[model samples]
Target: MPNSTTPSSSQALEAVLARVDAGLDASLERLYALLRIRSISTDPAYAPECQRAADWLVGELSGLGFAAQARPTPGHPVVVAHGPDQAGPHVLFYAHYDVQPVDPLELWHSDPFEPQLRTDANGRQIIVARGASDDKGQMLTFIEACRAFKAATGGLPLKISLMLEGEEESGGVNLPPFMQANRDELAQADIALVCDTDMWDRQTPSITTMLRGLVADEIEITAAARDLHSGMFGNAARNPNQVLAEIIASLRAPDGSVTLPGFYDDVAELSPELKAQWQGLGFDEKQFLADAGLSLPAGEQGRSVLEMLWSRPTCEINGMIGGYTGEGFKTVIPAKASAKISFRLVSGMDPDKIRAAFRKHVEALVPSDCSVRFIPHGGSPAITVPADGDYLRKALSGLSAEWGKPAVITGSGGSIPVAGDFKRILGLDTLLIGFAHVDDQIHSPNEKYDLDSFHRGIRSWVHVLASLAE
Candidate 1:
């Protein structure tokens, strides 16, 4: 008879990793099956498809011994699954089954729903489909890791819960409500794991430790009762376009810092350790600007490009409209001028306060005769994971071991509102780890996930879970 005793951590990890490697083909097959589902959640036409995706997930999780069910919401359903009660740290894994619409379908080399494994010009195997790298492929990495654990050890080392929602692409209007209603059940987990982000590069893995928040608004300035011929009004009338332009220009100082009053009041300085780590990333600022067809950095004088992107706040004019935007020239000043503006906020800053400050700044800049109207476009605060957390260090070590390179800690210039929602609602800090690359082209046609990324992503999760359990 074979000796039957508890396997050491290294033995268990090795077994699970071998299982992951052996099951790579099956894992790809399962991911391909998921990508075949046209689960576009934004459009009303794909409602049934969204439901089908949710149902498929429930079936898969239930088959894996989870108490999985497709729970109803005001919009699409959320698949909530729970594993058998265990003794280790419980983790809630979050990912969306829904994908962005595959519009401009002619641009795709193949059908977006029919995923294919093909080699790129650089000779790397990639899986091509709409949601290949966005979430479908990424989400399956965790599930496949669990499968390997089960196959190798007959059970998982820790407790697990899965939250796969179908409305993330459509603004996720109902997700907060759904979470609130089930807060007691969902909050039981020790931490949340999200897999809807990207890696720093092809060779280096990354954990997004901070995500900047957003505050967006639209402003309309009306200076005249009706459109007037410029010749007739000539240099005498108050021009809303000129007024709007001046206000936009005044938003930034010559040093490229936002000039709003008290804009930096709540902003925190980056720690010395984090600054050192980011400096070691060897980011080519010149090359970065060259790729964007620019010659110089445009934000925050004396700050590195990464620091400006990931730490500092920003004010940008997204769009502007006043008069005579057509092909031909019209010598008239329109009665109203409008502009869309947005602010990217860092940690410690409140979105509501930022929005209010922006409105106040614009109001002060408006001409006495001109009237200004504001339209709110919603806001969310920034999210930051603690640098010294035990879970974070363990996860990083796991990734480093799997990838054969030291994993990096990076910050995102964009926001994932769900991370904030997780903290606010469930009182859980989320670890935003994903294996997608920058060129994955998610939300665009011809989206793909590197075949190696998918395979090693499973093993990476296995390592992470084992390290956490230890």
Candidate 2:
């Protein structure tokens, strides 16, 4: 057993936070070094780069006095490390070392692999790179905090375990199996810490209390044996393009409601208390739409934009392909048309049920002598952490003290599958905290992480760890 004494001295925390502030430059250098590696997990061509990233982390953690190793998975490797044990809560910190592929390279002002320090329109100093804000910078915040703690106090305040995966940017096919196989070793933690979410705004910190689920499907409609000339068979032929369009059009009603039968059967309404709390966030829907080059809110008629994004279920046609349009205009009706569709699910919604309903709706629209095929993709259920738990209160208090404002407990419009998996497989509740802002532009060109966020994030973790230890 490790020492059970908790470090309750406010002066100790202050000293650690001061060390973090003083070591900010070295930390940025470390993050820049990691960001330079092209660890794109989706493309098999960069497998070696992914291994290099994992090895780099292993070296850094080992230098921090952690027993760390680069453990190989079927896909990219995972880096696991353990700090010297203390007798407080055993906590697991999770982050990804992989990043999304940067395409449309012309849109970036600088090379995606080169980390650059630039000032944004608002005069905020930011580090621009492909994965600067996504996971690299965010993950480094915790490591820097550990560094500061070790340097200031000579030890970590609690029992700490680190799990950094390299397949998060992809579908993470190897994660569930690995977690299942290593449950005994991995699940001994009291709670999981994740930094893959966004803050409420630029200056306000936030904790992601809920995450929407996802269901993806691809449908192909075949009308004729081959392409038919529009002039020759314009009226006689049933165009699969038109059929696919009509099927997509019929998915939602005029009120912006999904028409699929029982789509909302399992969905539950937000509690009045939760709704009140969301309303208090004072989200500006108009500003949000303006930033995206829009001027109106378009979802269910009555719900607020936040509710539509974070609470309500939605169906979106992600992509569609149909007839020909090469040079001038090919007057041909393609025999086969296809579309990719995805749904954002909330609590109580079953991904399987929603997928089945979508297929039924499409099959009913198929015309005579025409065939349709539904290709399933992936599905995951929504994740909800206990907002009233002791762990949450401790984290909230810690964040509030660091930022000088109460942390907003919010829901993400996006899905983090590992959050749900941690709960389902390891029976561990994950506390999702991050310093990324809405304008961070993650997974897009010109992605950046604010310098203030990088600095304050490390300090915030120092406080959170101290609170958890207490």
Candidate 3:
């Protein structure tokens, strides 16, 4: 086991952090080198660039004494690295090396592949590039921290595994299969760590503990045999548009709750401790709505916006297609209307059960003559790391110590399926810790990673790993 004494451990942590501070410039140079690789996994033309990125990671990890290799997949390569086997907690670190396609090239001030350090209007020194804040810069923070640990000491404090994928920006269709095939190797870790997330603010660090799952479904309703002219059959025929509208409206109540039968049967309520933590976040509901050009809280009245976003299950209409939608109006009632709907599920909610309830509700609302068909897109369950886990407390304490503020436990309103994959396939819970800011503009033109975030991010990991080693 690693040393847990206060004085020696503190001194070791301080030394590692000092090493990170001294090596900042060299770390930036290394990050810039990786950023220059155009690893756009979605585009077939950049396949070689993706391979180059995987190889580069393999080389870096291997130099760190990890048994690293670029494993091939149907689309891109996955870089798997294993650190020295030691008698301590094992962690699987996950990050992506691929970047999103940078369209609207005119918007970028410089080459997307050419990373530049410049001061922003806010007076923060930022690194600008396509994948600066998304994953490249964020991922490097951990690697640099490990470098510091090895440099300051001699080896890592614990067992570690690295899984770097080149197809995260694209659909990670191959990752689940890869994990399943290598389950025995990957599942040896006690926990997982992911860095593709953002901080609460510039000064406040946050760890996302809860991630809502998703269920996407498309439904088409047919009322009449063919399109009918309103002038020719005004009130004589039924319009599928109207039928679809009523059915859609019937799914939600005036109080902004789902109308499906027993929809909340399996829903779990927040713990008192978690609820109190969320209340302490000082979230402004009006400001949040104002930013979105909305003036009202639209879901489950009497709940805070943060609660609705982070903890509650939600049903929303994503899109709808009915009747004619063109420049010139067409006076015709279309024979078919389709709507795309999605549900955000919390812990204890089953996606299959929710889907079945929605289909049953829609079927009950349809007219006897009308027909409805449901098409399923995808589904995944919510992920929650036990609040009382040892690693969570250690990581939170480490983050708090690094940022000079109490690290806030937060939740994501969207899904990160890889976390769920680790749970289902590897039986490991993931800690979603990152150092990017809310305005990093990831996947957009002129994306950036704050210099402070990068520097302090490495330091944070140093402390976290040291704490976890205890």
lDDT of 2 by residue, 169-264 (tens): 998999988898889988998999999888887768888988999999999999999999999999899999999999999999999999999999
Clashing pairs in 1: none
Give me the displacement of residue 39 in model 3, in angstroms: 1.3
Per-residue lDDT of 151-190 in model 1, one digit per residue for the tens? 8888777889999989988899899999999999999999
TM-score of each: 0.97, 0.94, 0.97
Better of 2 and 3 by TM-score: 3
Worst 10 residues of 2 by lDDT: 1-10
RMSD of each: 2.2, 2.1, 1.7
Q: How does candidate 2 fare on TM-score?
A: 0.94
Whole-model Cα lDDT per candidate?
0.91, 0.91, 0.91
TM-score winner between 1 and 2, please give it: 1
Report the Cα lDDT for residue 309, model 1.
93
For every model shown, the clashing-pair count is: 0, 0, 0
